[model samples]
Target: MKLAAQRLIAVALAVGLVSCTDDPPPAPKPTGLNAGTGCPEFAGSGRQIEFGGEIDAELGGVVLGAGSTGVVLAHMAGGDVCQWLPYGQQLADRGYRVLAFDFAGSGVSRGHGVPLGRQVEAAAGALRADGASRIVLAGGSMGGAAVLAAAPTLSPAPVAVVALSPPTGYQDADAAAAAPKITVPVLYGAGELETSFAESARQMYAATPSTTQRQLVLVPTSAHGVNLLNPETGSVELRDRVTQFLDSYAPPA
Candidate 1:
């Protein structure tokens, strides 16, 4: 009987340890932006901000507009916050607060080694800290996979997600595995001519369980990732469709 009791206690301790390790680390405090040099010139009246992680890496970010519904824009691999600036400003003009941030080792952000999904989660916390009551995550390429993986586990969960040209997996984030677990509305888009990314979009959309809230859109061009939204190089129809989707599932007001 004593041996059985000891085994049970050991099992209980093991379970407790697993649970503690599974819980996400607490959100980091904002550390100010660009070391007080102010936001980039293109930010245009946006406020500069920063958030840190366990390794003391500080991510650079820009915030625009004012509202309870905030939109967090994550950029592509090798890209920075500038990649999302134009679209983010548009979302801000529509009454949604917007946050465009640089992941660790990208752009003005410092530090390395943090997982992509964790960086995304930290960005969401930064938006909430900036006074947003709700969140909508949007990303391009590698950023798209990161948001998809993070969405399933984010505290408070995002109200919606927009993924463009995302791969099934990018580094540490796996959108394919995360898709089935996402319960919120999601807009998946890619260029039809960009075969692999387009196929990934389709697979993820098909895998998502929310039949009524998931959408897949493929444009005619070969543009990939954020280029699909570029004013001069992208598809007008795709841009219009995204606007419509946001209005339907995540109205700014």
Candidate 2:
């Protein structure tokens, strides 16, 4: 009887150890603003969306607000949709339907060599499908160059464009070539201390045809790209200038 009891006890211990080993580890805690394959839920009214290019790559995006004028915001290189969420929320609050997206190879998006300008085109189409009648394009750094390059080709063209710290060219996007073709109102902004970008902005402005209503704004601060829109680190004059330009050109409906 004692031998039988000991055998039962050993078997029970072995079963308990197996069960403990089989138990799964607790899920890892969320690490950043983006939790998974969807838009960050912290973006207030922003909703997760997806747009695609000719390749299998599907770009992840977020769209918010309900306005007739649509604004497509492109992020700087190495940055993602999260970079624009704060500013996008502000635009949404002001009655502009804003779509901020991750370009291929960034954020939740996929793909390797897709042209950034084409990605912007896809984003604009997504915004139009979401109910925006008028489109305004905005981008920072690499994104700025992309929007400028894409502006001249967009169907119906953008009513206005805001390029902050745009380069003459980025990957497949060529703002230099596209500038001469842009006939709509264009606002080119950059930090006076970022000499290269400031110079590029000037050159693009010069290349823009005289028929276009073009404006060049150089702020005293050294902030670059979308940093120009940051309420904390960005410039007040630059922000005000952008607001004035948007109001004058694409007034929210």
Candidate 3:
């Protein structure tokens, strides 16, 4: 009887041990988690900073990086600053101060507020007010069109523009009409399999005035927005190429 009890006890111990072996997941890294390299300190949601101000715009956003060059990341329609959180942090790590915001009627932002173009322009202005002498505007999808619309309105003008999966015509913003007005270098891209989106990119590139230096690339992958930048989708070189493109025009942060 004692042997039987001992066997049962051993089985219970084994089960307990197995259950205890399950480890919890690693803690989430803070916003602007650095690459172990020298990166700027980013004040995230806790900061409660408001940068967007077109129509009483109390739009919320995070500011990362302290480099001379600045970048504004515009999220796709129906999305907000959170969409660009990871990307903004990495760009900050790479020496560029990055600002991403929620437009009115999106995310934490409220009110009918201003148009997309005005919202993006306000964001770039806020970046300058924060002390970024040089700026680069970047976005995806509807957000791409927003940056394109804002580019022509910048005072000193953004050093360059990067648009991914930007549509040709979306509501009020017209990429064809705005393309010729882009005064700085531009890098536009889209997924080859995205049909209309890919065609939209081509149209924008062609409409871009011959006077401006512009280039377009079609990724073989069908991912949209920054997803087209994924290396796993055979676009391994896309990210580095973008960095190189910015380095040439904006000269890095």
Using lDDT as the measure, the top candidate is 2
- Per-candidate TM equals 0.83, 0.83, 0.79
The full ranking of all candidates by lDDT, starting with the best, is 2, 1, 3
- Candidate 2 clashes between residue pairs 3 or more apart in a chain or in different chains: none
lDDT of each: 0.88, 0.89, 0.77
Could you tell me the lDDT of residue 67 within candidate 3? Answer: 80
Question: What is the lDDT, from 0 to 100, of the residue 61 in candidate 3?
Answer: 69
Error of 1 at 176 (Å): 0.9
Candidate 3 ranges with C-alpha deviation above 4 Å? 1-48, 231-234
Q: Which stretches of model 2 miss by more than 4 angstroms?
A: 1-41, 53-56
Q: 104, model 3: CA deviation in Å?
A: 1.2
Model 2, residue 105: displacement in angstroms? 0.2
Model 3, range 121-171, lDDT digits (tens) per residue? Answer: 888888888879989999989888888988888787889999999998566
For candidate 1, the 10 contiguous residues with the lowest summed lDDT are 31-40
